[model samples]
Target chain A: MNNFLTHIGRYILLMRLVFKQPEKKSIYFRQILIEIEHLGLDSVGIVVFISIFMGAVLAIQMAFNLDTPLVPLYTIGYATRQSVVLEFSPTIISLILAGKVGSRISSEIGTMRVTEQIDALEIMGINPATYLIFPKIIAALFFNPILIMISIIVANMGGWLAGSLTGMVPSGEFIYGLKAFFEGYDVFYSLVKSVVFAFLIVSISGYHGYYTRGGALEVGEASTKGVVNSSIAIIIFNLILTNLLLA
Target chain B: MIEAIEISKSFGDNKVLDNVSVKFEAGRCNLVIGQSGSGKTVLMKCLVGLFEIDEGRGIFGEKVLSRMSFDEMKLVRQEIGMLFQGGALFDSMNVEQNVMFPLSMFTEQSIGERLERANFCLSRVNLENVNKLLPSELSGGMKKRVAIARAIAMNPRYLFCDEPNSGLDPHTANVIDNLIKEITEEYGITTVINTHDMNSVIEIGDRVSFIHEGKLWWQGDRDTILMSDNKELNNFVFATKLTRKIKGL
Candidate 1:
């Protein structure tokens, strides 16, 4: 219990020291460029692949379950809503981001730790956590929801195209279904979830990466821990948010 | 001047440094020499407040780090410059950026002024015309030079180097040693060096502290250290076959 408390206490110290660091505006442009370069571009292939598959899967599942054959539009409506707001947009995006952003944060930080770059910062009177992690957090916070939103639009389009040609659903109903189901909560819910998920992913990964010890093998371990922990935390937090916000 | 009194550190049940007290005089190289895992690194860290001592006091000039708050410690840290074993250059930054990092962080120097100072420090370390190059582009010796340039860019009152000559050829190592010695004297900075190299000891050490079994075992100058009849020091110095052949021991 005491060890666990101290673990939490270090983060508090980390936060205080992070706050005390001089404003990192000097590195802002470089940070943003690096983040977008890494988190967005490096993961586009995976994001696209995941989103397309998720959308198609959701459409097929909803179509199989629905009994509204006379008005098949309900199948498309249910698929669009659930996939966009509940699962594909937030949950799937979070998973993809975890695979993308989390690993990079871990490895970059782990390398820094191994090379004593973080220690160099500390001795120079710079806060390593602030210098290293803050820009990443900010980039993840700002860019993730945007990426999620893009993923949603692209995935829904994929689902519509895939469903129409394959006879999984009728074309007339698919377009009408999406138009008719206008849940105001879809955009808000997914955006909120994306933001919170970004924080969890960035912070946990950064922590794991920064404290990496040993050598190359240990850095690999830290990277694995980073992705696994972030993905699990994102899922767990998803349920908590859903219960709180939806209930 | 830096002084450590009764400094001790442990990892769980394993004691790393035990009741080690040492003082570093200003305007000279205070060398800490021991084989690997002799607690030299831990002792150096304890002196710098990088690692907290289990029981001891570290006085940088007059203010003791053990008793100071984070804010107060920050003030004392301003007087410190460190060259880590691996050079620890910020890879993302260019040579100029890495050297100017300290100035930009602690001082509100104008961009022009910071660049000028960085250029000057780099020249002082004999690193020239490589300001725009990344660390990856530099040779191992060049990287070490850049780290030294960064360390002294702040014109610190105190300097510390951990295994500064590690991984370098003897010739490059000697050059680095001479540069550190020259800077220490020129700036009158109290320099503390953690080294295991005998060449470094003979070349730069004005005062050498031998740490053995987590204790300060012996203290003296390079000339005296070489001539000491201490059995352990003799064994350490003559461990290699070549050294043994040279010493006829």
Candidate 2:
């Protein structure tokens, strides 16, 4: 009972510390720049390409499913809006980010843990958790939303192509579909999922990497665990949010 | 000074260290000698706050490590320098960056100043003109030297080495031992080393503590180690055929 309480207590304390005032401890502007390059800039191409594909798929599916004469022209636009502002943009973007960001976090921290670089930071009076993990969490939080926004835009472009191909809905109708839902709720939902997913992936990967022991074998395990666990958590959370918001 | 009182550690059901206690003083190389699986590393880790003690208190100066707050312990930790068993230099950083890490974090020094100190330490360890090389490029001896340089970059008040001489040839190990001893004296830093090599016990075991089965079996200077009557200590100290022959046993 005590151990369980203590575990919860520690996690709460760490969360508060993580979310509390900005720590000047480990800004590591250099590392931040490197990670931003890796997580944000370098990842843009894949996210954009994936978004286009997702949008195209949604438009094609909607075109095939449409049988009602009254709403036939609205199908591509509605499908594009639903997928971009809600599920596809946030969920898919995060899944892709996990492969890039989460794996890098695991490898970097795992290498540090084994090399004693983390301990070296501690011995120098810097908190390894604060110095190493916090900046990563911050960078992920900072970059994920922006990347998600880009994903949504590219997906809309893809939907336009798919809509134009089917002749079921024109590119103009797809633009109209997006503008119709421009009450900002769709963007809000996407942002919400992106931020939450960012936190989950960065935090879990940090935890896994920080506690890594043993040798090369353990580092490899932590990397695999980081990607698998982060992906699973992202999906589970996505499902819950979709139900709660769209139900 | 550092004192560990009744330190014990275990892994699952197996107890690795049991009620080990001792005091290590400043400006002396205190060697913890034991054979493999004899709990030497556990004790050293317990002293360095790496292994959480099951039941013990580690007192460094006036601070009680077991009773410390996370933040408070971090403050004390700043004064510690450790050379890990595998010469845990960051593979990503060049030698200069590795040595400058602590200074860059904890000091107000400019980059120029940090680099100067890093270069000084590098040269002190007999490394020169190789600061641009990554850890992979360095030989085993050079890696250990770089680790030592990183440990002292902070001008730490205390130093702990886990098997500093483990994988090196005799010449390299002797050089590392002498450098550790010299640094301890020069900086007036308390140094603790964990090792099973009897050769180390003779080289610079200014003060020696013997651990067997997790207990502090004996404590003495290197000069008296060969003459100690304690069977456990004698067995470990004279386990080598060389020592046995000298003792005529």
Candidate 3:
């Protein structure tokens, strides 16, 4: 418990350093663009591929269970839309990112720490935390919402395709259900969750990486811990945000 | 000059540096020599503020390090340059970008101006035609040269090197030693080097401080070091049979 609290304290201190005013805004902007390419843009393909399969599976399963006479044919589409928009696209997809982007951030920073590159930055009078981490946080915050939007669009199209091909539900009914009772606030809640998740993933992973000690073995350990911890945080916050925003 | 005044550091119960102090003068190569785990590297880290000293303080010219606020310390750090044992070049950036990093971050120079300055530093280190290569692609000697180029990019007043020749062949090591010496003299920078290599001491150590256990055991010039009567210093300075034979001791 003491060790955990110490880590918490250190993490808070690190965040304070990370958010300090950048030495040069132009350089920071360039770094943010680079991070967007590495962390956000590169992950698009995987996010799209995974979302399609998940949406198809959700639609099929909903159709399979809604076979009773009392349930409407459109209920399958409704359930798939709610699951994808409210939870699957935002929460499950973010968990996937916690594994992908989180590990990358941890290992990159951990390697920098071991190599003394971070120390070099400090010796050069540059704020190492602000220079190394702030750009990543900004890039993720800007691009993650767009990625989530893409995931939503592709996943719904996938559901539509699965319904037409599998004959699980009529295409007209699925489209009608998708358009029916559409609350814009659900999208807002999802975007909110994605932004929060983006911050958690980048900051938590960066914390693990920045404080990495020892060499190769320790860097690997930091990466693993980064992914696991960020995933857990995403799950916990998913529940909290759901309660706070929707309930 | 940069000075450490009775600085002490400990990790848990293991005291690494105990009230150690030394002064490094400008336009000279100040070498800190010791056996492995003798706290020489720790002392260097303390001087650079990488590791906070438990007692005493670092004095850079007229300024007291411990008395400075974070911004003041940062300003002091701008005048300092460091070369790590492994070169510590940014893995993702090419040589040119690595060398220009400080200028881009600290100065309002245009990219063209930064490039010209980076070119001059690289040329000063006698490194050319490798600007597009990554650190991993260069030979060990070349990497160290590139690191030197980057260190001098800011025209710093103080230069610190930790194990600058640790993994090089003797020939390459000698080349690096000469380069550091020339740069220190050319820039009139106070250069502090942490090294265990006796060759470095003989070739470039204008002033040598020997640490034993956790104490500052001895201090002298390179020539005086060979003739010192200190038992621990003698054991360290003439550890090899070849050195003993050369000294006819």
Give the per-residue lDDT of model 1 (tens digit) for B1-249: 999899989989989999999999999999998889999999988888888889988899988889988767777787899999999998889999999888877777899999999999999999889999999999888999999999999999999999999999999999999999999999999999999999999999999999987999899998898678787887877789988778777
Candidate 3 lDDT by residue in tens digits, A85-133: 9999999989999999999999999999999999999999989999999
Looking at candidate 2 chain A, the ten consecutive residues that score lowest on lDDT are: A18-27
Compare the candidates by TM-score and give the number of the best one.
Answer: 3
Clashing pairs in 2: none
Question: Which sequence of candidate numbers ranks them by DockQ, best first?
Answer: 3, 1, 2
lDDT of each residue in A1-247, candidate 2, tens digit only: 9975774575456566555433344447666776677667888888888989988888878877875777757656876777677888898889888888898888789889987777766666666776677777877888999999998888888888888887867777777776764657778888989999999888877766777898889998998888888899899999998787767
Which regions of candidate 2 are displaced past 4 Å? A1-26, A67-70, A165-169, A243-247, B240-246
The residue ranges of model 3 lying beyond 4 angstroms of the native Cα positions read: B245-249
Better of 1 and 3 by DockQ: 3
Task: Specify the poorest-scoring 10-residue window by lDDT in model 1 chain B.
Answer: B69-78
TM-score of every candidate? 0.93, 0.91, 0.99
Per-prediction DockQ: 0.56, 0.52, 0.91
Worst 10 residues of 3 chain A by lDDT: A71-80
Model 1, A52-115: lDDT tens digits are 7777777776776774658455567556755676767888788878877888899989999999
In candidate 3 chain B, what residue range of length 10 has the lowest lDDT sum? B240-249
Ranking by lDDT: 3, 1, 2
